[model samples]
Structure formats: C-alpha cells, structure tokens
Target: MMQRFIPLGNGYSDIYELMYIGRAMPERVRHMLVLHPFDENNPEASLALVMKPTNPGNFQPIYICLEGVPIPSKRYDLWRELADELQHDVIELTVSPSGKFSDQEIFFQHLIGILRTNHYLPRLQRSF
Candidate 1:
C-alpha cells in the first residue's frame, strides 16, 4: 500500500474544500488531525484528514493544510464541527515544523512515521 499527503493549500479559504470532502464522503474519512509544529505560545496550526485507502489502488491519501491558520479562528472551529458531525474525534499532536525539513515530501514522511508509530495509521506490510 502507498501513503501520501495531498496538500489542500494553507488553511485560509481552502479549509472549506477540506470540510466539503468530509461532508461529501463521510465514509472515507478515517481520521481528523491537528498538528502543532511549534511551541504552545504559537497559535498557528495545521489541519489534516486521513482517508481510507482506495480499493483498487490501495493508496491512502492524507489531505493537509500545513500550518496556516490560527487555533481559535473560525476555520479551525468549522473543522472541529465537521468532525463532530462525522462522529470523528480530532486528534491533536505536536510535531517538528515542516520548515525544518528540506521540502514538503520530507516533512510528510516524518509525519507518516509518527502516525504509524502512534497507531493512527497502519504499519506498512512487507512483501516477500
């Protein structure tokens, strides 16, 4: 199975698009996540949704809006509300900021490891 992060753009207005996916395809939503890559003093956050793997392709896509919105903002509230309506609890975690990595790919790789280790995402199966 292959796992990937598909960025939806910075939270700003793009958050609506993320919400729409959750509402339109509620069954595909596996998890809702809020990643805080900085200290508590920082108010910005990243939102993400992990979707169930595709049937034919076995591709698990994690949609994200990397650290772009403030925690108490309307967008963040809307995300939480969507999760509630979908009966999914938002999972929050503190992680190293994406800026620490050389590129977005590396940053997502780091997050994948964390999600797997924490049992939020499935471990990769080895093929003999």
Candidate 2:
C-alpha cells in the first residue's frame, strides 16, 4: 500500500486537529502513532494518525506534526486522552530526527524505512 504523511504544523492547536480527524472518521483511523525524535539536543514527541486505505485504492495516509513539541509526555498525554476517548491504542516509535536529513523528503524517506523495517509498514513486494 502507498503511504503519505500529512504535516499539520507543530503541536497544541494542530494536535487538536489530529484528534478531530480521528473523531470525524473513526472508521478511517487504522491506528495512531507517537513518534519521538530529538531536535538538536532537545528531545521531543509528536503524534500521527494512520488512516485506512480507500476502497479501490491502496493510498493509506499518515497525518503528523513534523516539528515536535517541547514536552514528550505532554504530547503523549494528549494521545492518551485521544486513545481513551477512542478506545484504541496508538503505536509509539522512537526515531532519528528529521534534522538528520537535508530536507523533508529525505526525512520522510528515513521514517518510511524505519516503519517498514519494524514491520509497521508493508514490505516493498508486499501482497495487498
């Protein structure tokens, strides 16, 4: 399946938007992801929404906040609250910072690699 990450800015307000997407489309929410990536020397956390692929298409989307928040636990708490409300648990992963790469495209590629390696993402020759 094809995957895409929809960046929704930083934390706080954007997090609310992320939660809203879950509430709005409960069926589409395949799962949630909490990505912890260090920014420079400061470690931070972020949230993402993994959406179910559309019918007749393999386009699955993962909405996230590329820039992380100062408090990892706080972001995780927000995700917890969302999980409590949704009655679904989110998958959490610690990854290398986007800053490691030269640009966003490469950063996303790195993330895609991490996910696939962890079996979170379908393999290259995956059967659909």
lDDT for each residue of candidate 2 in 59-115, tens digit (9 for 90 to 100)? 878888765666545666877888888878878788888778898888887887887
Q: What overall lDDT goes with each candidate model?
A: 0.91, 0.78
For candidate 1, lDDT tens digit of each residue in 26-58? 999999999988665556899999999999989
Which segments of model 2 are wrong by more than 4 Å?
38-40, 72-75, 125-128
Clashing pairs in 2: none
Count of clashing pairs, candidate 2: 0
Q: Which residue runs does candidate 1 get wrong by more than 4 Å?
A: 39-42
Worst 10 residues of 2 by lDDT: 66-75
Cα error, candidate 2, residue 18 (Å) = 0.8
